[model samples]
Target: MTPSVERVAAAAGAWLDQAQRPMVLGLCGSQGSGKSTLANALKAQLEKDGRRAAILSLDDLYLGRSARAALARGVHPLFATRGVPGTHDAARGIALLDAIRAGQPVILPRFDKARDEPAPQGDEVPGRIDLLIFEGWCVGARAQDDAALACPVNALERDEDPDGIWRGHVNALLAGPYADLFARIDRLALLAAPGFAVVRGWRGQQEDELRARVSRGEAQGTQVMDEAGLDRFVQHYERLTRHILAEMPGCADLVLNLAPDRSLKEKP
Candidate 1:
């Protein structure tokens, strides 16, 4: 395991040690910052130590493509693309957390990014879990101030959402259902990338890996993007990603600062 994985696992292990009931650990990071990687590693470590652990990625909870299309028609065009608040099934996430906490059997949803929708099947946890790692790009994010919403953070916002409707709607969702969902986390950890400037390179690496997986028949999906398409897709996440980086560090229970290359720059 990497140092980040070890560090997070150590923290999560400690959290589980003292918990009176099932615990939820929220892991937040920007796109391609390895939130999923760390969560999987931590889950492995937990199970090795005789704990029942599971991971629920926020990405997998995204509303279906058709749902997002309706959102675009009714709300904003940007909703047609996932990655921001209002794109996920926050109620489902909350219910999963609740069920796990109550020692109930629960089914976990999975999103097939290749097809841009939910997978045909889901992961069913037949029994209660001791720890749940809820990881995502904006898992524990908060809504930005209305004043901050007035300014366009990127070309996507300035040109397409010039009226601020899309971002405003996203912000409202963050302050509402998203807030309630995040509140259930027993502890929150952050994999802090150096800055948003490095996100494209990290995200591009993910796409490259996904493309390779598809070619090898190990994964399914034709949603891979070339440079230009990828750049535009990255724009969909830039605003709130920047916002999370700026604010999450100070408040996150554990913040692991990373270098541009995704290595630890400083210990948590």
Candidate 2:
């Protein structure tokens, strides 16, 4: 296994060894900081050691396009573009965790980015999961100060949300339901990218991989983003991602500082 995977797996194994009941491990990272890679590795290694584990991705909890359209009408126009805090169904995420802790069989949610909606079917986790790897770009993000929301972080905010209503709304959701959902985590780990500049490149590479998958008939193509679209889409996440980078490492249970190439910068 890779160094990053090994480190995360070791930490997760230690957590499971001491956990009496099912536990939720939140893995937070930038858009392409390898959160999914580490989450899957932890699950595989845990299972190899004879424990049952499942992954619950925050991406899967995204509100469908229609729901987001309603959010846009009721909240901010920026809600129509996903990836921010208010765009996810935090109540559903909380209920999923609640069921897991209750020793119940669970249906894991999945999102279809190409269709901009939840998938028609979800994977099932039966017989009580020993560990739940809840991974996402902003899995355990905290809201920024109201003062922080007054400034635009990028062109997307400056040009479209000049009054800061959209970002303010996102911060409000983070401080409310999202905070409650994240508080359920038994342990939290961070995969810290070197900086947001590297993050943009990482996210662009993900889009490239998706495009390749689409060409091979492995993924749907309808919502595939071109370079320009990807650039703008990533900007939607910049402010909060920057906040997490600056704020989370100080408090996260495990912090894996990543190099620009996405390799571990130091031992955890």
Candidate 3:
């Protein structure tokens, strides 16, 4: 683990020490802001301290392509994309958390973004978990008020959702099921990027690395995005990303501000 990750983990461990057993830690951040990386590092650190830890990602609970297609047809066309609220199977997420809290064995699901489908079932945990790290872009995000959703955040909303149908729907999901899921978290952390403008570049860098790995035969049959495609793809998440940026820091238990270059800027 990097020194920064270790520092975050150390503080997180201190917080966990006072919490109840089978604690759920929610790590929220923008796309490519290193939430997953921090979750994994914390999991390792917790294990080193003789605690069994498990990590769960909200991405893995996303509705399958076909389900999202149905939502697109019934709700709004933008629902066809996976990043926004209303695109995840919230019932499944709740069930997984219930099982973990009940001390039952559970198998996490993994989503393959490259193929736009559920990849495979993750490893099964046979007993109660000591710590559960749940990470995602909007993990701890709250619903924006109606007035906040009045103006379109980007071209995607301006052009495709002039009537405010899509954003309104997403906000409802956040106010309901997503809020319930987040309420189960015992502690919450935020990886605050310098600003929303930095997200596109960070995500682009991730795609570049994916493409390089595919070329070296480390990844096969992956659906990598080109620069233009990446830009459009991120637009779907712009509104909520901005909302989290503005709101989550104040509510989260720990906030790690990240610099434009993606390094840890300030400790919590």
* Candidate 3 C-alpha lDDT tens digits along 1-268: 7755776688777876886667788899899898898888888888898888899899999888999999999999999989888999888888888787676889988888768898776778889987888899999899999899999999989999999999999999999999998888888888898889999999998899999999999888887888889989999989999889899888988888888877877553
lDDT of 1: 0.90
Error of 1 at 159 (Å): 0.5
My TM-score estimates for the predictions, one after another, are 0.96, 0.96, 0.95
Cα lDDT tens digits for candidate 1, 62-155: 9998999999999999999888898999999999999988878898999987788899899999998899999999989999999999989888
Candidate rank order under lDDT: 1, 2, 3
Model 3, clash count?
0
TM-score of 1: 0.96
Q: Which runs in model 3 stand beyond 4 Å of their true positions?
A: 1-3
Using TM-score as the measure, the top candidate is 2
Ranked by TM-score, top first: 2, 1, 3
- The TM-score of candidate 3 is 0.95
The digit string of per-residue lDDT tens for model 2 on 100-132 reads: 978799899999887889999999987688999
How far residue 155's Cα lies from its native spot in candidate 2, in Å, is 1.1
